[model samples]
Target chain A: MRDNGAMQHSARRDDTAAQPSRMQSAVFLPIGDEGRAELVERRIAEAITGGLIPAGERLPSESALARSLRVAPVTVREALVALRDRGLIVTRRGRNGGSFVADSADPAQFTAKRLGAMSRVALRDLGAHYSAITRACVGLAAARADASEVARIRQRLANADAADEKAWRRAADEAQTEIAALSQSARLTREQMRLQAEFSPFLGLIGQDASAREQQRRAVLAVLDALERGDADAAASAVDAFVRDSVALLIDHQMRLHRA
Target chain B: MKALQATDAPAAVDTVTAFFQRGVDALGEGTRELAADVASARAEGPLTRAKLDAIVLPYAQALFDRAGVTVYGAGFIAAIGLLNDASGHLSWWQGPRHSKLELAAQNIGKEHIDYSELEWYRVPVSTGKPHIAGPHVDYLCSDEYTITVAYPVFVGGEFIGVHGMDVLLDAVEGELLPLLSGETEEITVINAVGRVLVSTNPHRATGDPVRDAGDTLTRYECEGLPLAVLVS
Candidate 1:
């Protein structure tokens, strides 16, 4: 006897509902102390950039976070305050109130002064590091990922390209993470997320320019195309070029600001 | 008595497999989080092998508890320093139990114990899969009969190293010994290579070669492991 599609459809619906909470636990838990407050704050910030914690989501309460993290309640409070100051979070005072991720109404902006203050050496080193990691990850993804995994990555890349300016920063960050996950190594994915978090505040500066945004999309698409074809060499080269070009542009912009 | 022992084998196999599977999953998750810590540590400046090991130390404890193994070690292919924890459990070579750090320091000077060449670490890095490496002597950690489980740990898509767990063969024997009590006829557990790992018969010891009984002995393979239950 043939059953209706209701059972299968409902099963999928249940999965969709369960996914965010699972992602929340996976992203948030297992946070070891590298200076508890700083690490926790950085992780939460990275989760936001990686799209693990969506905008407008309410954060766990301070005590609850403290209990789960095995940190003093005051430590979570301090980190939350720092996040609020950075405009990454907002706090509500009412009875039904808690900390919430800031709405994606405006992208966080980095000024020319901030860019110029960073030494050329530091900027170059950061870019070189990311280039090394991401290239290796993309190559492995090309060699290992099946068609369906490639499709998921392509979809994320497309979402980033289509996003509005305010949401594009996070969307692009997530696209990089999605590609890393296709490498099928949890370690690679974590490294990608960490590198993205480290550079995202600076990368937001370039997102304001439409031409720059288009260039990024094209660069990612090239990598995507190579991965879909299962060409590891091409995939590595495309990722290398993409990261190299972005670093070059950022350095050029920094030099211009310094000259001005 | 023979019937009771027969019924117990399947249940015991299920319990053991589930235990180790959960351990593998937990260790994998812990090591991924450790990789993130390593990346962040790099953001501050370049990290040396010892510094990297230091960053890994706190996270290594969970691998021991979760895997239900006697000791857990994470060794890099290129690094000189290895991060490991055994919860201060001493091996047969020690006079009194010492800290894992002391044990590691004692073992570090030996030229014979090359982690790079060990099958437990090497096989997983080459194949990028979890592997079982012993039922032989673990010269470095326990100096007793041990079995090792090694899982490849990759960061940035590079095969950086392996995460390994060493379970004392005696400890495994302790866990399996109780089930052997009810059997009347000779019942033995054998490794993949036909060596007796555990036996209900008092005279037959572990690590001894199983004597050929030809058609008299029937062997059943355990699920998800290279082990067999033998009946006569």
Candidate 2:
């Protein structure tokens, strides 16, 4: 296991909280067996929408991405082509040129498309995976996070304007990611952040609904309160409930959009 | 030798230390020379990106080429990062099947990349000392575990920025393993922060904390480098 000291990738208080790809391995985990261009496209699209590889940051070279993902370089080229076509990434040439995530990526645009395409099972599966990692992470935080650090996170939990999609998403992201960093296990924290990126597009949609945002805010605070009280099980359950509620909301949203 | 005793540390591992000393010394040598080159270029005119690239690119790529496959394996010392606000980050890296290094889009995008916040960039600027940050993921290009050796560049006493090389962890393991392998005692090489860089012991992988054996182990300092060999 990588020590937490070795895991400090950013100068930020929550190293996992950065938009840039601080933990490339976690975000760029290999795509084993599935070599389809669409799968590659989907993987990168999620990373782009989720903010693992933030806007304006250059992507790894095609060959490098292929090597890490264990796919053909041509496959990566194809994926890049798709992402470029969708206006998610733009590629340039010359000394300081490569494919960069576009400067203004509306995560809502990507999420709306994704939710419509995803089957109910896929949505639930993603939720289950994310909830499992977040639960483990928060439980560890409750057990290991020092009181001062926990308090610092508590202070930073901004009161997000629920009606503003961007404001609510940003606040939710910062709160959840900083709390995950408190786990003090760099690997777990990085993994949780990456999964959060994949989960963000769906979560971003919930910010438009005031009640949904309030529910998420309370669930996150409940987890934080549990952590402060040193109740590992309570923190885990709180996050589980949070994920379950969000996934159900997303599925319902997806159905309504399809019906309309 | 005096420094080792002054710190009340263990013996100096000449052989092991020399290996890193050579690499770091070479990396430092380039930046020093580049600093002089930049100073002269300024004397002639303004230091434009083109002007800087004309001098920096060829030299940095040559350094990568000279490092060769033996020490670096598949992961040659990655592109040399020339970072400063004026110059931004200009990387000269080995592209796919390329003979010499060429400028690659290793954070070439002009927006959203805050180079100021990275430890490798932060430490040298803060202390004016060469810093090695590693056993962390490479956010620049490759997604592998990496070690970045960075040195500050000063032009006419003005802190311009830094020039550094990102060395892959596996390449590091390959370089140090031969001398360290097959030891009866556990001999692990750790970075300045006490994270294992490489180890003769199979269990202690890179990034694992070096556990002190409580008087059972002797710590040997690697002169002039932020590294030590722990023997138990």
Candidate 3:
């Protein structure tokens, strides 16, 4: 009877793929030895713009952030002040208060600036990193997930209209993440989600074009088709191409946006 | 000699049973305390998230501390049907020094799954009995091979959810290996799902299905739990 309302998450059976701490992904990753407050500010700013930390979401306590990022509490404090000045994060003092990403964040507002600032080399590197993780996740999903699971996610993806980029991005993100979960490795799924949060904002800027959104929709569907067929290589390759195409498109868009 | 072995078997199984029962009762005590808090607080007014967290978080922390190394993960999976939020309200916490689980969180790129299908959540809610589930990979939470002991939480007659602890497979083997030692013949312990918990046979392996034993083994069911000691 319980199965009547059951989620189709049983695809994670390979047993070799356990992985991620929710907080430790991108936001909690250690900063460099530079020890500069600006670097700390920039690191957290990327997480916010990337939407890894959602608007109104409370950040780790100053001490907690300091310990995880391996920076001094004063450095973290300095970064928070800068983030507040930039209107990226806000601090409230109370029993429940801590730093929170400002609710006014439109994601696109922060992402445009972030995308323009990145060198094409850094952009390609980001895409390659995301694709490598996605390839593994899709390959595992193909080997472990049932056709029904893939079909359920495909149905969600198929229903999202490319014209409505926001809704499409939301559906696309949910679809890809659910498919990644089929890898049954908590770490892979966690990284996949983190990368999506970190990468989707750029995709959002690029996806503003109708053609770009349509192209991405087709690529996602192709990957799903291969996954449903239980062809791991086919599924993995489809995702690689999907990511390759988006990254290339994003690089072009960035150059075009800032044309001299 | 046969009569002596028959009595010895029950005594041996009882020791293993008592060991698991003590852990179950520890988790159950917290469930009852939280359920009482919820029921009484609801009697006064509406269920606020702050109030719920105040009731649930302490119990979660205590369960984590009290169970110590035995429990790798601990918390409450609120029956959203009772709580009336399809999105879910989970107060689960896990270790390597306490992190909240996002299995039920609604985030971009993250889907909130209906956990009712999972045996650990399903059995206790359906049977209204405490249950011991798995030696399987926990994709939803710990991402480890886990043996989950769950006690159903009920507020008056309404089922609130489950208060539970996850013992990692390594720790489970640690607890079971000594209890299962010195057997005259090969023996395997399997969970409710028939996944081997521990076995003396090198080839059988933990998580091997009991059905694969191929009629060569004799199965003795552990009293009240979905566990068995199989001798071949």
Candidate 4:
């Protein structure tokens, strides 16, 4: 029994390994010898996409950011320029002069473009990849999460509301992240955070629909019920179903957008 | 030293495996792009190192960024480079690669960084599988402590080259050493041959052979690579 459990755990981890190989074209970026600008750009972009840096927030001045990041001022300037070029940030002149994240950066458009470019096979493969990690995570959480962890997840799920697309998406990420964290595996949690940061902007579109929101709620409740009972298999299955349903919705939505 | 706890072994393995797995995933993405380029004849016939750099380096950079991994360098190597140009072996390195100093020092025209024999390249080529080579010094490349994760690239049944990345030894230590949960217990990540990759002990650093021979020690094989961890 113990050996089986170990094997299952390792196999699930391996699933994450396989998914990235298939996701090759979706996330490539150019690296330059002077890496600081690119590094700063990605960090800022992630913060914005992850909602840590809200839309319309003023960024620190070029020199200030450079000092903090320990990069040359030119590097910060280059990063700001790139961000501006992408319309992710805007620079204001005069006393109010500084870079600010654009209001409604519309990250969804970018993510949707990438998703729309992928073949159905790639999309399904990605969906399976996410499902496997999440299933493993929730399974371990169901069997091992402490009272507080379970309660925290339950609280997050209960509080989730789909009235606003941004809030709902944030809640979804928080809920998934909480569940993944319950496994006490940093690797799983890190990957969860990355996936949410990369995909939530696009997934938020699906949450804007009432029926989709209801289905998501049902899935979350089922997983919560399994966790409450310490049923690892049930928790795993619930998460799998939830991810599959979400993936199907997203793919259908993407196909429509592609056709349009 | 303390004996391994069954509970901790899995986490330790998970941490190391995740690091290596992410590298392979990035290479897989790069290989796909390179293969597509080759098929389209976009880069055909006597592909110069500079041409290969322009064509493939962006994907490598993207992988490095998306994964948030720190590495000394990462890029692809064409096998046929040796038969043609002198500097063909080192096809790509991250960023504005092959800085003038490195170019001058490494003697691109005369010297050969013969990768065909390196375990990282050789194992993957032989098995037609991905392999992790060395937590040892890469004198030919970084001249510092590093491990190379390599994947073989094949097009039309022809072995074109290998896509690879080099993770600094200190970075691996920084990433893997803190996974040790106990004060007295030690964790050492090892390759299939039991060469230490990262360890909680400074004396048993990267490239040092694990003395325990992986026997009587709680050894857990890292998924996705023929590597294991000895938590003793």
Q: How far off is residue B103 in model 1, in Å?
A: 38
Clashing pairs in 2: none
* Model 2: per-residue Cα lDDT over B61-104, one tens digit each: 65566643222211122122332324354443433332222223
Q: Candidate 3's residue-wise lDDT over A25-118, tens digit each?
A: 4533555676479888877887678765668987767876775566799998999999999999888999888888999976776787778888
Clashing pairs in 3: A17-A185, A19-A186, A19-A187, A20-A187
- What is the RMSD, in Å, between candidate 4 and the native fold over all Cα? 21.8
Across residues B1-232, which tens digit of lDDT does each residue of candidate 1 receive? 1222334564545444554455456656766776677667767875664565566555555554455544434322332332232111111112122123233223211222345545566667777777666555544454445666666766688655565566666666776566556666677776655666667777876655465647776665555555666767
Error of 3 at A36 (Å): 8.7
**Candidate 4 DockQ score?**
0.01
For residue A160, give model 2's deviation from the true position in Å.
12
How well is each residue in A175-221 modelled by candidate 1, as lDDT tens digits? 67667755644456667656876676566667668888887778778
Candidate 3 lDDT over residue span B86-135, tens digit each: 33566677767767654412232233344676668888989999998866
Cα-based TM-score, every candidate:
0.44, 0.61, 0.66, 0.45
Better-scoring candidate (TM-score), 3 or 4? 3
Candidate number of the best TM-score: 3
User: All models: lDDT?
Assistant: 0.62, 0.67, 0.73, 0.67
lDDT head-to-head 1 vs 4, winner:
4
Off by over 4 Å in 4: A1-34, A46-54, A60-70, A93-97, B1-232
- Per prediction, fnat is 0.00, 0.00, 0.04, 0.00
Best by lDDT: 3
Alpha-carbon interface RMSD for all candidates, in angstroms = 17.5, 7.9, 6.2, 17.2
